[model samples]
Target chain A: MSATHDATHDEAPIAARVRHVEALLEQRGWLAPGEVDERIDALAAGGSPANGAAIVARAWVDPGFRARLLADANTAIGELGLSMAGGLQEQQLIVVANGPDEHHVVVCTLCSCYPIALLGPSPGWYKSEAYRSRVVREPRAVLREFGLELPASTRITVWDASAESRYMVLPRRPAGTDDLDEGRLAALVTRKGLIGTAAV
Target chain B: MPDRFAAGDRVRTGTVDPPHHTRLPRYARGVCGEVVATAGHHPLADERARGLPSTPRAVYCVRFAAHDLFGEGDHAVVVELFEDYLEPAEREVRR
Candidate 1:
């Protein structure tokens, strides 16, 4: 057998590793289940991706700042005090904005690898296996399933997040809100806004 | 791992040599691009084999132009890929 195979075989099973970590954390009294759950609930209800939307909104209003964000996402996002963590930290976090001819969608074929730090925990359907396997290969079809129908002429970009790179779609700005300030624009940029639908 | 490619390095999405665990999508294979900026690496998600204790692996962020992957036109899609998913192109042309 190859050295890598031999090594992997000798190593502890993944389940065992999970149990080991759990046991260690439990022993150390660091696994505060109740408190963690509460914290998650609060963060979720507060709107996790809202912060990202606010940044996008400000960029839209300020040409110079928008150049900065388009040039460098991390630094620009950091200026707003958001650090990519959870699954986002390891991957490239790119904000794909919707243009007149194109629309972007995000999915993880293997699992729900998301930019949770910026976008919060994924919605229920996003984590489902049904969405994962079917989205990348059949984006237009799956998007139709989501009740989003685009013209046949519109190009579709299905971002298959498999590795460290995570993606968040930026929906187009809504009409009638052209005069809205950054604060109002931010409020409009909802979670669905980051999902490439429902302009804020 | 820190960023491996500089601003001008040419790269391509590595072929999916299956029978191994990978996060690369099937559609991304063989696409080419010039490195825009290097995004830092994070953990490796080899959960199927490594299980829970598998620590994160270093990854680099590389950006590909929309025209290269799709086709030439006024409308193009830009894409960024993590390092593990890329391979050095046969000819390295600095863009």
Candidate 2:
């Protein structure tokens, strides 16, 4: 039980502590030997940004579905048999649309809340204290740091996602992509696009 | 259950600081805003963190102008806050 880790022991302290805790749980019969690894593998595969890309692609092609998605995101998303819920309460998901004159960005001022089911692991900056504090106070400057420089006339809406709901940005469809199929359109969508930090 | 406010109604976030987990961020405390949408009930994350029973409370998307909260900016900020953290923004006595 007191044995040291292998030759490659450069893991971060917090990660090492987590592994140590998991090992203790496994020995105590609390966790099946491989349960932790199995769950992590499943989550990594299941919560990819491609999930959000697929939704965006569908919305770009189908006006009716887009209307429904914007009307009530959780219900509309559930219609596709996809869930956005996590933890104790039903984490309601909201879809905000960006347009020619309007843009939307999401941040969790208090914490790094996000739409993990659709957007996958959030970028480190999105969860940083600098971002969490500055985005709401100085959104344009923050956006500029992300290399997105919107026109002065455009209106930006910064959404502070909280315990009750998560927000996803519906980035505007890029010009000259009208002829592209849904699969091709989806391929062009990036995680940053879904977070309103970049254009598709 | 009836929500404390409806869409278009003016409201303000509360200022009390709970020692436990709270969805209300300090930046939004006491800030005035208007309710744009009503999300259904959910357990209080603050109370749940303390192992106390929390009834479902109505949550709302409150939209505040940048000028109102940050003192400068052209953009707007919308925060999703649960019922307990909100109160009616006292309307001025109309002429």
Q: Per-residue alpha-carbon lDDT of model 1 for A104-172, expressed as tens digits?
A: 777776678777767777788888888776665566677677677877788876655655567777676
Clash pairs for candidate 1:
A90-B42, A91-A164, A188-A200, B41-B59, B43-B56, B43-B57, B44-B56, B44-B57, B66-B77
Tell me how candidate 1 scores on lDDT.
0.65
- Put down candidate 2 lDDT per residue, B1-95, tens digits, no spaces: 67778899888788898777888988788888899998778878888989999888888899988887867899999988898898887883221
By TM-score, the best candidate is 2
Clashing residue pairs, backbone N/CA/C < 3 A, model 2: none
Q: After superposing candidate 1, which stretches have Cα over 4 Å from the reference?
A: A1-47, A85-92, A197-200, B1-20, B26-38, B42-95
Instruction: Name the weakest run of 10 consecutive residues (lDDT summed) in model 1 chain A.
Output: A83-92
Tens-place lDDT digits, model 2, residues A145-194: 88999999999999999756788999999999989999999999999888
Please give the interface root mean square deviation for model 1, in Å: 4.9
Candidate 2: stretches off by over 4 Å: A1-15, A78-81, A85-90, B92-95
